[model samples]
Target: MSPYNALIGGVTATLLLGFAAQAQSDTLADIRERDVLSVGIKNDYPPYGYLDENNEIVGFEIELVRYIANELLGSPDKVELIPVVASNRIELLNSGRIDLIMATLGVTEERAQVIDFTEHYVSAAGASVLARQEARFDQWEQLEGQNVCGIQGAYYNRTLTDHYGIRLVNFTALPEAYRALQDNRCVAMVFDDMTLRQKLGEPGWEGYKIAVEPYEYLPMAGGVRKGDEAFLDAVNAAIVKAEGEDRLIDWEGEYDMPPSDHIAARAEAARAVAE
Candidate 1:
């Protein structure tokens, strides 16, 4: 190629890189100027982010996001909550529709390439099976040939099918999967352990039990567009402060979630750091 053409291409690439860097670094300042922190959240997954009895969105993650909003913007109300699901949350973040994602986002190596994660605040239980109380299966290996209800785009779907040999009946959302399980379409339903446990306690689930326990636990954190260092640091600071104040423990009780050792230890660590 001619030197002139090469020089023009190099200049164009440098300009694009500069524009990208400015986009990320300006998020915190933009939030301050707008006076609202926009966050992507789940409105169907309970105890984390879900619709309450009144159809209002409320959950542990919602509370945490509000706390961060208050810390950054001086009021919990100074935030916009945008509903997001597993498949599209990162896309929404990168497209600038949301400033941050707090939708039960599990930290993963693949995801890190597209977006940066805040300090992990929750150790989420991985896939567990929900089946009839009388169901005999108690191990993942036992369900090798069984059809299991699951949500599409769930991180462990491939793992369950490829490693454990379970045939997945994939749904776009949780309610459909749960309904399919009740309709006896699948022998069992598989999803996050915490959500399945919560379902077992609700009305109409008395006949069901967690037939198989989660084979793994994943660390959950908030997500931001890649290179958003200023916003990421601010969000992490608010999270640590909340932990040091035992707010997460209180939220666990409020949400009727079982206590977690991971949260408790993080609280202690945050307090120690503060001291």
Candidate 2:
């Protein structure tokens, strides 16, 4: 073979080998061998996954992932929680930065095309505005012309802006917007109901409240990289087993969320799928 042709062939073979190595990555076996269950979780969205007063990540999703770790590795202490946010969670998963994404990832057809999701675990949640009662927000119609804080990459920003003509002050992190809310930078923070509700219940947020209830609902699920059926199936089984054991109900209680009929029904269905 010509020298130029041989060099090209060698480069192509090396590139092919790299892709093959990534494609054949056995995440479950790696975790087992490393004795670490690395999971991506939200560190700002409270009651799902957030930092406590001690700066430790703690919440219902944290507990759920810990349960899965305990089941898989025979010890919850082996779990390593990697903090993630909305815009980059899927990218982090697909890029192999994290083994699984247990963040409060909403399910949608667009997102499913990019990454695989386990069976829906949490019931569908809706969007709402966390505003100070002084802002006097009573309905969605009242939001017109108001400046609302929102997280970057959230679907709600376009809806609030285009649909309602509201001005959006976008932030990369929820905590930044939360600070903006505290400082009166924005009239309200538009986000998922669960995170806002959790913040509202905390003692320091005395004057803030959800101005209006959620207008729409979306399912939430655990996310994993694509083309790994064995790992996906194992994670799904862990969730299903937990549902069958009523851990979802316990999680609701532990997280201080009001009893949810939708969550109960969803848990029942997940358990049925397990059977």
Candidate 3:
């Protein structure tokens, strides 16, 4: 073959190889070959994902993932929990470092563009202030000039700072943000209500109380790499089963309060369609 023809042939071969690689990367078959479903979780988030007294990873999300692994692979032991932070959960899933993310990931349109989300298993609301006593802010407008602390990437930042006109300070993690509140560095610290309730029920949380009721509700779902229809279906099926039997609610009861009526109603709706 002439040199020009040889070059064209090489280019075509490379293109074919690239397509093959892409196909392999997009399938669940590769996950089985690895023999473990790698899951991304937030080790610092309490009642959701965290290290237990026995130094093992345990929480609501962990239990949910274990259930998924058991239903799909015949054993919950087949999963490997990978600790991740808010900054890296999406990157980890996109880069294939983890098979799925069971973190408390709130589903948003921007996130939907990069990853697929399973049916929402947990419903969340915007962050709210936790106060020391009967004092409270009735509306967002009442928070003007007050110091508010929250985790750096919390969804309530824009509302709290821009809309409410509060001075916001963010910490890298929930513990730090809560500590700022405890230390009087801020009038209130903002975090998820479930987590804040769990914290307040702790031995040391004698003074704090949820200052305002949850303002807005958001559905939370698992994050998976995009375009894996098979894997996504499997995960959603597992979620439906769990929700139908109230397994997620039961699981949460192990460490905290049972799912609220809203959660139960949502789960019931999902179960109806799934069946």
Candidate 4:
């Protein structure tokens, strides 16, 4: 055989071996071996996943996942919470650092290609406007040539700037964006309804309010690795059970406002299917 042919054969064999090893390294096997499900969450987003005055991680999603872990593993204590950021959530799941993600993950087709999503637990709609309650921006189109503040890697930036013809000013955190709105650095800050409500309700948030209305509703769901069918199925079953028992909505109500009509409708739908 030629020298080049031998080299090609060796490379092919190495690649095949790597693929075989990876195929056997399934998330189900890891979870069963450890007897603990690790969940990824955001430690900063208020009313969803954030540290409280006690310096403990506590929020709606955190509480809901505890109930899910209980139903799945027969004990709520058999889970670990790994705090994650928006940009790294998918990578953390793909790398097996966490078995599930319950952060405020927006479900999109692009994301679904790489991870499996449980039934959507929360829904959101995007809107943009300044903090001034008396501002008259009635639609997203009205923001042309106006600067809007958003998180550094927010999912809505492209749509707000490219599609909606608004100038975007990116911030590293939610608080920064809120501060920018308060300081009048930008004419508006685009964010989802749930988060906006929480921020606006914070003390000294009298200037900011939802504007331009909600253009679209985004379904938010938990995430698992792409090929973990068993884990995905278990998580979905747990979600359905929570919906049927009203546990998910109750948890959301505890930290955030009550579940919106859309969330209730989705929960009811999940219940119907589960029944």
Each prediction's TM-score versus the true structure: 0.71, 0.66, 0.71, 0.71
lDDT values of the candidates? 0.86, 0.77, 0.75, 0.73
Off by over 4 Å in 3: 1-26, 33-35, 132-158, 165-192, 203-208, 257-262
For residues 33-106, write the lDDT of model 2, one tens digit per residue. Answer: 99998899989876788889999999988988988898888998899899986656665676677889898876
- Which digits, one per residue and each the tens of the lDDT, describe model 1 over residues 29-63? 99999999999999988789999889999999999
Candidate 3 TM-score over all chains jointly: 0.71
Which candidate would rank higher by lDDT, 3 or 4? Answer: 3
User: Once superposed on the true structure, which residue ranges of model 2 sit more than 4 Å away at CA?
Assistant: 1-24, 128-192, 195-213, 273-275
Q: In model 4, where do residues sit more than 4 Å from their true spots?
A: 1-21, 24-33, 86-88, 130-137, 142-192, 203-208
lDDT of 4 by residue, 93-121 (tens): 66667889898887765565566788888
* Winner by TM-score between candidate 3 and candidate 2: 3
Candidate 1 clashing pairs, residues 3+ apart or interchain: none
TM-score quality measure for candidate 4:
0.71
- Candidate numbers sorted by TM-score from highest down: 3, 4, 1, 2
Instruction: For each candidate in turn, give its C-alpha RMSD to the true structure in angstroms.
Output: 8.5, 9.5, 10.1, 9.0
On lDDT, who's better, 2 or 3? 2
Q: Model 1 segments beyond 4 Å from truth?
A: 1-22, 129-191, 202-213
* Model 2 TM-score (2 dp): 0.66
